[model samples]
Target: MGEENLAAVLHAAEDLRLEKWPLPEPKENEVLVRMARVGICGSDVHFLKHGRIGDFVVKKPMVIGHESSGVVVRCGKAVTSLKPGDKVALEPGVPCRHCSYCKEGIYNVCPKVSFFACPPTSGTMARYFCHPEDFCFKLPDNVSLEEGALLEPLAVGVHSCRRGGVGLGSKVLVIGAGPIGLVTLLTAKAMGAATVILTDVVEQRLEVAKKIGADGTLLTGKLNEEEIVKQIWNLFGGDGPDVALDCSGTEPGQRLAFLAPKPRGVAVMVGVGPPEIKAPLLSACLREVDIKTIFRYCNDYPAALAMLASGKVNVKQLITHNYKLEEALQAFQTARSGVGNPIKIMVHCSQ
Candidate 1:
């Protein structure tokens, strides 16, 4: 292991630098990890550009990254599940286990969670950091470190599928063909959805979604709400889909999620958008379309890894670019520019 800990730190909006952060040590129940791959998320870009995500604001310098995988360098005395030299996928958010939400097995909403790369919480875009042993899942022999890094987003898809009740012979509609939407499409198909239609404003993204396994693709670039709804119904045998997932999180996406589902179907908000958006609540209520929202993920990492090991989901296809820790700014630039339709950009943290 190297003596110097290099990290991608954000000083303020649009001010990112590679600084030497103090290497973290493992605590009684944590393990020290040498980070290998850290995937850049949309939130990371948003924070870099604006320095705030809703209420979470970056008031001081903080390390930035969350979707990461690494090898265990040292284990705390109480970390029985993992040992040195173990390769693992890190679950970023660690919640207070005593909270009511955590006790109910829905810890993703625990108000006391210390999620990586969010405002005040320092993230894992460094050579070494410490995490609770329970939050790190050992990677199967077949799963590469790159794939392990992707498990974080894949877990979101798994959680969305479960929330939307996606199952055998189901028909699903996913809005926005971005990384989250693509993963949702793959997860729905892997869960045995009979048909999965993906809608996106970007033609290139829709094309990628089709190639990956979307049963149908719709380019709703200029289409209005009614037109999109009509097109979606036509794509699903002249009827709405059994489940609709709004991965875009735009007002239009939220409205369409309620409008594009069959009566008594499910509508899930997988992406975080504005604090408030005008949605068709009355219409959804009349049709009995249940609505649900996802906050990160809970108890879904194992399922995501299992899907990867079983060859049921291939997340590597979503990765469009890669960079080293030193070239982090360039990577973020490519991601922010949307050049070449970058889907997922990965930053290698370990030498």
Candidate 2:
């Protein structure tokens, strides 16, 4: 192993430097991974551009990626389930098992959780990195590295759907045709949602949603939020969706998620929007709709990997761009620009 690893480090907003960071050693319960693929998530771009996501701020130089898959190059003595050479999809958050949340299996909300790319914790945008062994899921031979890297977003969708109670015969409304929204759409379909309606301001994104089989697509332009909600209701044949997921993290989209669901339905807030949201809680209360929210994810990595292995969900086709790790700055530029109809931009580190 090299003494130093190449990594994309974010020093401040819009400041990313490719520097040689010292190679990390595996802890007793960790495994050393030679990263193969790393996907640039919206949060990653947000951190690069704005230097923070809600309360998590980039106080110092931090490695800037989390959606990752890699080959196990070494394992600590205490790592029993996996050995060297295992291809794995990394679940980036490691919570304190002693915490009450972790004890209850909702560790995603652990107050002391250490998550990649979330300030103070270095991430996997490097040639090599080390993570807790249990958090690294072995990938099946049929699941490509690219697909493995995609599981992070897919897991978010899975967790959101689980929270929203998306199931057979459920009608779903997904507000946002971004990567997360698209994954939510795919998951809703896989979970047997009878009808799925998706909305986005971007026609290109809506086109992707349509190609991926959203039953209805709403292009929100010039229309007021109420008007858009009316159209969304009309799209569902005026019966309202059984579950509405707000993946856009905007106030309007979240308001749509709150108002577009049926009585006693579920509305999931999946994206991180402004710190203080102004959604109508009383309106949802009047309708008796359940409002659910999720953090990153919890106990979903295995299920997501299974979906990929079984071909239940297709993530390979969602990748719209790729770049070597060295081209990370330009890649971030492209991701931020929102040009080229880019859906998922991935950065590769190794074979």
List per-prediction Cα lDDT, in the order shown.
0.94, 0.91
Q: How far is candidate 2 from the true structure (C-alpha RMSD, Å)?
A: 1.2
Instruction: List where candidate 1 sits over 4 angstroms from the true fold.
Output: none
Using lDDT as the measure, which candidate wins? 1
Query: What tens digits encode model 1's per-residue C-alpha lDDT throughout 72-131?
Result: 999999989998899999999999999889999999999999999997999999999999
Which residue pairs of candidate 1 clash? none
- The per-prediction CA RMSD against the true structure, in angstroms, equals 0.9, 1.2
Top candidate, metric TM-score: 1
TM-score of 1: 0.99
Name every residue pair that clashes in candidate 2: none
